[model samples]
Target: MKKAKTISLNVGIALALFAVFLVPAASATTVSIGSTIVGEGETGVVSLMVNDVTDLGGVHVNLTYDASVVNVTALTNSDFDSKPNLYKRGHGWVLLEGGQYESGLSGSVKLCDVTLEAVGKAGESSYLNLTDIDIETFTYPPTDIPIDEVINGTFTIKPVTPSAKVVINEFEQNPPGDDSGNEWIELYNNDSTSVNIGGWKLINSGGKVVTIPDDTVIAVHGYWVANWTNGSLEDSNEYITLYNATGTEIDNTLTAADGNNDERCWARYPNGIDTDSDNDWKYQTSTMGETNGVPVAPVDTTPPTTNVTAPPTLWPGKPDETTIPSGTPLPWTSEPVQLWFFRTDNSDSGTGVAYTNLSLASESVADLVNVTISNNTWTWETNLSKGKNTTVPGTVGEYFNVTISEECNATIEYYSVDKNETPRVEPKKNLTVRIRFEIPFSEVTPGTRYTANVTHDLIEPANEGKDATIVFFAETATIDSKPYYVLDINKSVGGTEMYVGINETAENFTMKRLVMKNKTGKIMDLTFNPEYTMLNYPLWVGKTWTSTINVSGTVTYANNTTIPINIITTEIEAKVTGEENLTTPYGELRCLVVETNAGILDTGLSKPITITAKYWISADEKAMIPKYQSYINGNLTEELVLK
Candidate 1:
């Protein structure tokens, strides 16, 4: 039977005590690291002790503490120094081990001694937690024995002396040039005492906190500036706070706009002036660990834009013009007089323009000017010259009050006569006609027959849109009282009409019928059937079949003349030769290629027309139609392909 172990709550110890359980609650060994108090910066020792145990052969101690508030500087096995052992130190961990004590250790043995330094803020406490341990103890060096409990400890950092007056002086959030060794925070000490700001937190508005390592200090009336331990101070808005070891909020800089500074920083006038306000701060020349100076940004280097406009002189159309307005006689006074004709040419004034007439507002000939302000205005006057250039000539009183600017533009309206008065440049008549395929095969109705132009692209580069004829025979109505398949051919432009032979679709997918009328208005009765069988199904590559077309149709002409119907039978032989991969505008398709030969047979017409064609039929069962067809005319001079 396994034994139950009672954990000591005051010791803050817990363990599983699984199948390899404790011997008994009474036999439980209480192992501990005793608590103590030490002054800030002072180093102290805590002993690892064991009680309520008769004998111990081997021991292992695993200890943990706050590496920030108190550092486990070093450890020793002073009490067990004579025992063979090993030890190591990490962030907040201390491990000690010893083995092979043949005589065994008895009750109240000191397993190890750990040294800790009170390195953080004063009045803060750190716990030296005894996390886990394993001990093999017995008089006869038994391996089955175990120690079941651990007692942790605490360290009180007692106050030693008063703190110095150290204020966050200046910080460079946006540093000049390379920030490599420049992003820093300076702490200025005004008090005569020295201060150690160890285990301090520097947290930003992002909730990112970085610790100031132990032993960071500021001397009396001096500054202690250091680069950040986590990341550089941000160039954007930043709010920073400092906290001591006990998590006490010491000081903080309110969120400030820090990105706009041009290689400068926010600083105080009198170095350590830490008032949190915009007035208490200024964008200044960054002074690292020294007195600050007034802010001075670099000289402006952007250039300016200049715009100038000069209009041509305007002359009177009907009569000789003269200037009337007069000003100070300056340079260019010897030039001929030209008047600004500001009055109406015929309605108001009898004479077109007379420059000598000062009563009309132009006082003399020297200062005459006229401003054409379609969107701009300019006045010309000569008084004196500040420089020998076009722009610097001076002007005086009685000037034209032109409010328009030089950059204003004038848009001239012009109308062009239409040579051919039509809405667009299209021909007076239809340029080219379109023979449209009225309905596709998928739209056919059941139990009907149809004739249509099945080949929509019969032009060269055969993928283009053109026209061909087809016929349909719908076996029965399949949906909404419509046939299963349909075929229609509707001329797109300027065709009077076409005679309808068979204008419906196939009965089913496997059978087909087609009839063609010879001309427009030609009558095709039920007895005038132009028989056509379109496909041989139940097919694969190398499938071959022969079919016969027996059609009797009347011949008709534009004069309303009709001839008697004659029966003619045409025989066609077809073979699914092979398969091919074809790419169309729709997409890629795997199609079976069929070669067919058809003409008037032994019972057919006297002048028989024979056609040999290769048809590319899509392999998809749902889309069993010919995607392309290629053939040659009777003369074989021209090749035809339909897509």
Candidate 2:
């Protein structure tokens, strides 16, 4: 199955309510966060549930929560919604809404999930009152009229229970990502009934503590979770301790997990069972706020034998090229072309292949490139004599966000990325997938596209130049106070192309080594740029910002001899000019127009002489990204509209 979209702290909520197509008749759809019963000083997630929702295209959820009482931290899609999150919070009200250009979700969907911090006074009452709700449909002829329904959630805040019997159930100091936002801890309530836990504190090994907020409650024998970057545990030899309102100890001396768990988190099996020993806690795939899920150990102990290769480009290439140097950037072709790629995975792990998926990026297609995605996995079943394929018509948009299995094929059509997902595989077995597709040239100015990224699942070294999750350019987000973006940097090695990944873990894009080709068509490692800034967010009208960038990387020709990377300093400046009512496949929206003049930055060496772009930003606060973009560099580069 395709991996779910990941949201980093850098890119806020604008992308949260992403592009999930919904189709249903709105028989008055009421939306609300389930009874808001949070405890003061506690951090938890609230759900935006829909009751009696049919053929739901999109929803605009606006609600007010006493800012003094609770603060929203992040948003996640409920079982019913699948798209990058599309919601915003400001002025005490959150505006949550999203729809797909070609699809819709059906009845009784958990529209979205809200992660918030309860920061109210004990016994202070606050309401997560649904102020106004608008459910719109974009079926052929658009429906400007909104759907109405009974709100599904209730709002109620309670004070802390001084004698509550909540204990630290399971915790993970580190899980994954830039190594910061992955830690979490679960609390189990052994009491007879739900207990309010506001104004409590969870202390770390360093003695630092964060207070629990109001509205947090644990039902009889239920569980609650504190999982966010701000509330993360230390990924070291630290300990976790829980304290009540009066500083009474609840749970303590719990060891923290190390900093490298991916897909796995520390959990307790045999619910509520504690031995005060490491054996009491086992590391397994995280279950978050639910019962201790099926225990499975981390699979990183042995790296899978992976080889991802792309056909030669410049001219379109075939799918069977085995040598690495066969693929090279055409750098000048702009017309449409067919792309074919292959991947093979072999492992010694017992769960040979539980499941796997692929995600493609928007950059992989032209402005209006149209194509079909067929599922060939079922055909292989017959080759293995398993019978036949799913036989369903293929669709790109439908498969855009899910994993393809025996019963389902690729439904992706629009969106960026075809990331890979994994499944439990048998030991010493290899499973391979070879996919090929046709993409029209990135039709733009100069009548041809200059730079092309051969689409793949990931952009890292071990996998050659493939990127399952293109972090660098996935989406734009707001971090501390500034906005940032992740970009995949491509390099040529052995006359072939290779890719590298960059993440701002150290608060900047930390590039340490450069992998390139030497003259003998061999890969060479060299020193590269360190932490640096690539882009910014929070751009407002009449606001101009400048950033100095150092362009540095080694250059190698067909000859084995290579020159050390050159370091050049360049200045970049950008400004927002006006607003635009941008139109997309979803609908029309008001956007911002930001003009930039940085020619050098375009080449990663010098500033651009004349760079103009209309970043059609929405009038909405969380619409930080341009819904429609028209950019002009030395040549007409890109013109795109969000679907």
Off by over 4 Å in 1: 1-28, 74-77, 81-86, 138-141, 144-148, 160-643
Q: What lDDT score goes with residue 488 in model 2?
A: 27
RMSD for each model, in Å, please? 37.7, 32.7
Per-residue alpha-carbon lDDT of candidate 2 for residues 1-643, written as tens digits (9 for 90 to 100): 1233444542445444442224333366566576566676777777877666556676755555556666667778755343325244443445566665666667676767777777767776444655445565647664744445455443345655545478887776766675566566788997878888888888888777767887687799898887644555667677888998888987864465566757676677766666666677766777777787544554533322222333355234545444323222322322233233222234333222112222322322222223232233311111111111111111111221112222111122211111123432213221222222211111111111123232221112233333222122343434334443323233332222212233334221222332433334433333323323222334345656655555454443334445443565655566666656755443565555765554333243233334343445443432323332223344543333342
| Winning candidate number (lDDT) | 1
lDDT tens digits, residue span 65-143, model 1: 6556787765566445345232444444555666553466666877667678887878887666654356765445356
**If scored against the real structure, what TM-score would every candidate get?**
0.23, 0.22
CA lDDT, candidate 2, residue 210: 66
In angstroms, give how far residue 308 of model 1 lies from its true place.
71
Off by over 4 Å in 2: 1-28, 79-87, 144-148, 152-157, 161-643
Model 2 poorest 10 in a row by lDDT: 380-389
